[model samples]
Target: MESNSSLGTALLPEESTETSFWRKVLDVEEVKKQVLFSLPMILTNAFYYAITLVSVMFAGHLGELELAGATLANSWATVSGFAFMIGLSGALETLCGQGFGAKTYRVLGIYLQASCIISCFFSVIISIIWFYTEPILILLHQEPQIAKKADLYMKYLIPAVFAFGFVQNVLRFLQTQSILMPLVLFSGLPFALHFGIVYTLVHWTGLGFKGASLASSISLWISLILLATYVVCSKKFEHTWGGFSSESFRHIVTNLRLSLPSAAMVCLEYWAFEILVLLAGLMPDAAITTSVIAMCVNTEAIAFNFTYGLSAAASTRVSNELGAENPGRAKTAMAVALKLVVLLALVLVLALVFGHNIWAGFFSDSTLIIKGFASMTPLLAISISVDSFQGVLSGVARGCGWQHLVVVANLVTFYGIGMPIAVLLGFKFKLYAKGLWIGLICGLSSQAATLLLITFRTRWTRIDLSAEREQGTLDSV
Candidate 1:
């Protein structure tokens, strides 16, 4: 009875043990794959983000009023419009990502179309709000002159909003497929051209401040045109993209369910930070306090762009593996991403700690403002590290189709727990900007911890793709 089966069974245990070891411990190949994936994404995102910033810079050169107006308009546009568009596109990270993994290639194109449609619809609604920026800014207690200038900037920037929506959706679509290299060229090219375009429009043309806003519109459209042309014309997407279809319309409601919660998840966290700036304005030397907080917020945003790539990579890998029915692999991908983001965050925090004075100088030469920012650097460092954790974890949540849960988590942590602590410490305790920032840290930490717990406690299991497609919900496995 010494059969071949007995001999094979004897060797199976060692093979299983080796496989389990790799699964449980650090995975070099997976880390390498993610590294390669994240770098390009970081560059692509940074380039695209700079395009808008460049426009604000050009507008600022005209005068202080133009700067204030452009800055306010930019902030309002982000809170009310850009952030939502980014959130709406997050649905594709789940749908198209898993669909690609499942080899249901055609759905990627359908989801892309559906997401674009949703973005377009929202852009229209948001445009209406942008039209009345002056009143809203006045309602928020902003100076009337500044509010009027912002309205002028926003009016010209409206067309860009629609283009921006499409760009974000396409980004998710391509990112899920691991088609990243093109993104660098698509985004980088426009960003490089944007500077010249802005300078020409603002200086060469007679448009001045208005030219800066219009330049943004043109540059964004350029990005959309390039990306859209690539997706439509390239044979690489032959399987994933079938030409326009009515099927996309059917998926609109399905996409909306996921999109809305995802938008809330992003907006809650964003608005919380914006609120801190508003709170800073209430402090006794309002000018210095507001400037310092705004600088910190800007610094944090720049830092986040670095980790955003890893977050995107995490979402893509987890979703794809889940779609392929490899739960263990999906979990491992998330682990690897978390490790990378933490290490990256450490490097960034070190830079901030050592170069706080230098970095603050870029925002303002006022010694008082610079010194104030220096005082807040350590708090900024802590918040940055905490944000890195949540960024990647949020990506995993998207991969797991848990945006709805994340929305609730953001609300509770930011508004319920974090904000109250901030108000108490900031005002009652007289911690000023530092106290307010500390409160933000509390919220961020709670959110990060909650998301981490969610990732661990929730089972990483295969999604029932057929049932989900039929029911139009990507709930828990």
Candidate 2:
């Protein structure tokens, strides 16, 4: 194998042909580095998701109606606010990760600012949507009671939208520099505080469902403040954190050229599940079906956090290698990240299979709801496993600046193929939630396969790292 000095390590020796592939994979120092880099990110993502799950659990304890309402509101928030902000901010993963590796330090801060600005602008529009969520839900033919309560719940979550945008911006800034510990510390600490705040507001203050929403918003702002403080005070960012600049505004269009497609790719995948929940709400037993699917989806979200961390690590590693003008190392990084995520996925699949009955009980005491969730585990396992690979592929695409291509892939597979199948089996054939989830599995599988083929066929050598460098320099000028 060709050696890649840019990784500060060498690939497996070509002469060592007798060595087993798995052993060579394990022995590679770069693989270990990638795992370590992703570990903290995974933990941080877990805590972030945990905070939301806790809110949902709190709502579940109040009543089934409350649970359904909270789930609907939360789903809308994710589709309208969180996914868009996170996806748009992913432009940083490409720009900042490569910038850091290329030693173009200042560009990272500039990109971070640009992403923050754009995300904040979009948040305003999303917040307005949230303000009218009740009407929107009614328009979609949702149950009137659930729509009313969910709208009330979404009202308190509006502030968190902007806070979330800032958090993503700062997180990307630190992530690209290989700074993972602060993210863990800040996110984990707020998550602990979140439970207490939620309990107090919901029980002691008698705010009910609104309290749970407020708790989520408050926790996000706290995390955002802590992270922002660290970025300002930490010496690690001395080179990257040049104070705010007018350049951020100027680069808005340039950054959107990447961010919009990224947003589309991510939103399409995320909204597909949200749409599943919406479809379930219109089924025979709206409350039970929506509640059950929401619980299962939450479980999948937790697992997705693990894969998402791997994706982030892949993006950083691949972008770093490419920025260093080592396409060979970039390819190696992708291969290593994929292998690690697949192993993790298999382990998760087994755990979900064995623990399905027990896991569903965590969210609700209702036997019917637990049984409903358990029935979906097999399909969830399949979807989650395939989605793990798809997630990392998306990260790789982001690093390679192939966001536009993936957007097309996501739209075709998810909408053109998956949605029609879901609607057919779910409603026409009356397979209900199972049919919807199975459709999602098919969509993920198609997306994963398509991305894999693209990665395989890519001409990495054709990437013009110098031209990217020149463009960044010109933008700064």
Candidate 3:
């Protein structure tokens, strides 16, 4: 309570006192270290996106038909997977954030177990999805040629998809600890494995799309193994790997309850986009391929990784400060995160707008395809800017544990209003692909605006540090 600077952007009246303007945007000295922490994460995540782009690059080279089929199948896979997995794994962030905040390490182990169980439970559902991949593609009534190609490509990913979902849960647990390097390394392992194996398998075995999928699947399992082994070996807990107790299970259940709202929030957000892809199918071929532009712009995985990493750090910073009972610092941290997000968004816009022509060339050299992508760059830039806010606030919401409210916001903005309009414009008005993207932009704007408002209104609020008691004297750390 001892300071004020006139220049600071005091978001709350209490924080405004004598704080410098820059300080309002961020607590420079304190947040500096966190910026460093976030940088690697951003880079790591960017690498992830880059890897996916590489995958797409390889597939795109296989011919337009292969590219379209692979992209469609992946769209379905990601959306469906997020429906259950993100909701389930989010418990890790909530419980882990609070646990670290309160120095409640013992309880974190319990939450970890719960996250694992929930992830595994959902993995079963995702695995079974392979059985229906062909059926679902057929139901789309796409040309039989496209459907058949998509089904086979999807089948290859089924095994990998199982491992991928579970691995993400493990990564979440690690991220909560703010020990994200392992998660990054572990996440990359699969990409490496996939590329190496896919190249060889596709060339020699003639499995083509199926082989590539299997490569990705094997890579996921490899990643999972590496991370699980790390958790076992890490010194943070002497007996973390010890068998779970009923009390631990109870604590785990509590963590799940806390995280379920977040899961729903994530699922609803992604599912809306999933619906967009389906609706896009109703358009013409040139129209459908036009989506490849959105997908490409949206798929700038590396760029997104940077934002998500920053957001993750923001969540940790907010949760930790709040748990330490320092609301002022929490407010500062949130501001810093928001500022960083906008800054990052600006960078993305510039890159896309100026380099749209060049970027498309790297992705493909087809003049017709290249021209379509270039035309959409400006809109793509806008979408990227808006999404930056969405990504950041999602972390803010997680930090504040407002999972349910976030979902409600997502539904109202994206589904209740955004999707319907996009569909109407696309079909009725004949806006085609442009209509679809406009709809997406509108929805993202909805999410970003609402999340920013929420973060501001809830400024400096405390994260719940409460947790079920540990099983015994063993959790004293």
| Residue 56 in candidate 1, Cα distance off native in Å | 2.6
Cα-based lDDT at residue 175, candidate 1: 98
Q: What is the lDDT of residue 153 in candidate 1?
A: 93
Model 2 TM:
0.94
**C-alpha lDDT (0 to 100) for residue 96 of candidate 1:** 86
Q: Candidate 2: misplaced stretches above 4 Å? A: 1-23, 466-477
TM-scores for candidates 1 onward, in order: 0.90, 0.94, 0.87
By lDDT, is 2 or 3 better?
A: 2
- Evaluation by lDDT, superior candidate among 1 and 3: 1
In model 3, the runs with Cα more than 4 Å from the true position are: 1-25, 48-53, 237-248, 286-294, 297-302, 362-365, 459-463, 467-477
Q: Rate the local accuracy (lDDT) of all candidates.
A: 0.86, 0.86, 0.68
lDDT of 3: 0.68
Candidate 2 collision pairs: none
Estimate candidate 1's alpha-carbon lDDT, on a 0 to 1 scale: 0.86
